[model samples]
Target chain A: MNALLTSAVAGLTAAGAYALLGVCAVFTFRLVAVVNFTGAAIGTAGTFSMIGFISLGVPLWPAVVLGILVGTLAGALIGLVMTQWFSEATATTKAAVTAALLVGIVALGLRLTGGQSPKEFPTLFPGSAFRLAGVEVTVASVLTVVLALVFTLLADAFLNRTRTGLHLRALSERPMAAELLGVRVRILALLVWAVTGAFTTFALMIIAPQRSPDFMSLSLLVVPALAAALVGAFRSFPLALAGGLTIGIVEGMSSAIDGISQYRGILPFFVILAVLLWSQRGARWDEAR
Target chain B: MTRTLDVSGLVINRAGLPVVRGVSLSAQKGQISVLLGANGAGKTTLLEGLSGIIPTSGGDIALNGRSVIAARAGERARAGLSHVEQGRTVFRQLSTEENLLVGMAPGADLADAYDLFPELLNRRGVRAGLLSGGEQQMLVIARSLLTRPEVILIDEMSAGLAPVVVQRLMAAVRRLADAGLAILLVEQFAALALRIADHAYVMRRGELVYDGLPQPLLADPDRLHHLYLGDVQAA
Candidate 1:
């Protein structure tokens, strides 16, 4: 019973990180009508940033802040390119930009460590555990879940309660009308990028320390996060959160199923693809907006 | 009543093809100027050019003595030129109130839009996509009013609307003009255009073929039939 509870709690923590990443993906997808495949690359970039700062003898506090700051800057730069250079750019062009960014960032990661094996990441939270209902839950896991909830709530509030958020939604839904209404369409697009970038960076800084911060390992988070976003049909915050948690739990549960762990990598793809195909029977990207 | 818009030798090209050729027109304060044309007559294109949404290949658009052809859409709007484009281009997903709010700048009085079309205020929280055609037109026109533009360019204000709705829209146009807003109305309906226009210009194949006062143009049935209406016998 203790083992089962601990597994579930750990699964819940992983879900929180997935939710954070998923929300950012949804934000970008809704605003620009493009799925960001390179989102994980941005996370990897943040991890490198954190480690780079730490290597320079900077304290952990400043290093973390510096990492998040770099992430924010990355988001702003990506947003600028998408909005200004690609205002009238085609769908294919936007996708190309994200793909290029991902490749460039990953290449930068290999170059930064000079082919040395990637090291264990520094922790943001104390690696301590507490027992709840006979379940041992780590401090990092609790913090991840709490932070994810906080960010998602704040984002939801920002979208539903603020005038600027309304304008941004208008810009996303019908760009031409928003423009006529004097809403700055280009700026809104850039803003979406900035917000997504910041979130991706923060999420990476929080999670990268638990695993290898190599390009492939970090980039794989895109699949689950994207699955979370997809399951939400690109809307509904609660659903996205639930979806993220579900993926994380499923990922955890699969580990206990005898030889199923060997095929764990293949399960998410089949499950997500099937679920998406079933749910999105007649949905089109343009019609949603 | 003190607004004026003057377009001189306005040349517009789309994809290297000339759409409006050296077309010069004007709308004086408290006056309604109508541009009458057949399908693809470059009527909408000219309005877009004046509003700064479309790039003009040549010529000048001056709103109250300030050149606006090269200005950005928002800048031109700030300079007191508003456009109600051919399509009732309201933000469809936004609630009626939200759509109106978007057009109402931070500094402007939103109540004026509601004053012009009180029905929009009634359906304030409703999504704009669900509004009736006439209601959508009213909302769009009312929203554009937020800019308090000296010149209001309306394209096909009557298209796809019921006759009574068209009458209401035309009446609204008249009221705006009476309040000193220079209005450039582009329409396909000759009778409707002539009803409120102080002056009218006829376009055929992207060139201005006739420019004159409304009464004389309306009275000459034979000339009108040959130039605009398909046939007198058919009418």
Candidate 2:
């Protein structure tokens, strides 16, 4: 029973990071109508930059800030390309553009990192564990869960209770109608991109220390994040966060079963396939949007 | 009569082929100027070009005596030019009150909209997509009114609606015109549009074939039939 409780606490810590990534994906998808595939790669790049700055004898905190700024600029750059070059493109075309950007960013990150080997990631949290109900929990784990909940509440308030949030909700529903109604869509899209980029960096910063940090593994974390966002239909932030937590807990629990221990990595794919099949049943192919 | 919306020699080209050729028209405040035509007659295209949704090859569009040819769609909207597009495309995911808030200009009040469309007041919290077709139409028009526009260009306001609902919508539109808003209405129902129109224009194959008072076009059925069905004998 203690073992099971330990695994659950560990899973919750990981779930907080996954929830952050899922929230970013859902937010960008809602505002811009594109599933941004480059988020993890951008986060990976930001992490490498922070490490590089540390290697150069820069202070740890400032280096992290600089790295987040780089990620934010990368996101803004993607927004600039989307709004300036492909503003008139269809939803499929815009999504394809994001896919292409994902490939480009991954390649750039691998080149900059010099190799795909795992590197030791430094943690900002103090190494301390406390006993709770006969289960040991790390300070970082508590911090992660608390920060995730706070961010979620703040995001919900910003989206529902503010004027800009109302405009964003309107744009997500019908972009052309929103434009005709005098909403500055392009500017708002750029802001969403910047926010998503910064959030991605923050998620990676908290989560990367738990595993071996590498370009390939860190960037591929988007797959599970994407599955979580898909569970929300890329609309509801709270649902996406809950989906991410559920996925993390399920994955953690499945590892205890001997029969399914080897297939842990394939769980997210099954969730995605199940969701797609269920949502598309009896739905028209041409009814995308 | 002071002109609220004035257009002269407006030309629109789609893929190098002219869709609206040298169209000229003027709308006065407190009146409805109806554009009557069949499908593919370029009525919708002309309105799109005027509202800056599509590029115009050559034209001058003046709103309240100020030229707005260089403005984009949002800029035109800010300049008091409101467009209620075809099919009444409301933000389906937003509530009726939220939709009205989106269209409201700075410092504008929602009480005016609620006063104008009382039915919408009762369903303000409901999602716009869940509303009935007639209610959706009323919501879109009510949202546009929140902008306090000087001129409104509405396309196919009565599409796929019951006759009684259409009558109610038309009565609301007449009230708007009576309240001194210039209205440019495009419709396929010639008889229905002529009843409320002070001036009317008929288009055939992207060109204005007739421009005069609605009484003459309503009196001569053969001319109206030829303009729409391309057969004078069908009248």
User: Could you say which candidate leads in DockQ?
Assistant: 2
Chain A TM per prediction: 0.89, 0.91
Relative to the unseen true structure, what is the C-alpha lDDT of residue A196 in candidate 2, on a scale of 0 to 100? Answer: 83
TM-score of each: 0.90, 0.90
Off by over 4 Å in 1: A1-4, A89-93, A112-117, A280-289, B1-3, B228-235
Model 1, position A172: C-alpha lDDT score: 75
Interface RMSD of 1: 1.8
For residues B1-235, write the lDDT of model 1, one tens digit per residue.
Answer: 3438888999999999999999988888889988887788788888878887778988888888878777777678767888899888877888888877765765778788888888788899899999999999998898888866778889998898899989888989999988888888998777877889998888766678778888877888567656664342212
lDDT of 2 by residue, A1-289 (tens): 6666667777766777777788788888888888888877777778878888889998999989988998888889899999878877888898889889888887877787877877777896766568778777777777666666676787789888988988888877777677777788778888888888887887787778885588878888788889889888888888888877777767766767678867977777988998899888757555653
Question: Per-residue alpha-carbon lDDT of model 2 for B105-179, expressed as tens digits?
Answer: 987789988887899998999999999999999999989898888888999999999999988888888889999
CA-based DockQ, model 1 = 0.48
**True-structure RMSD, every candidate:** 4.1, 3.8
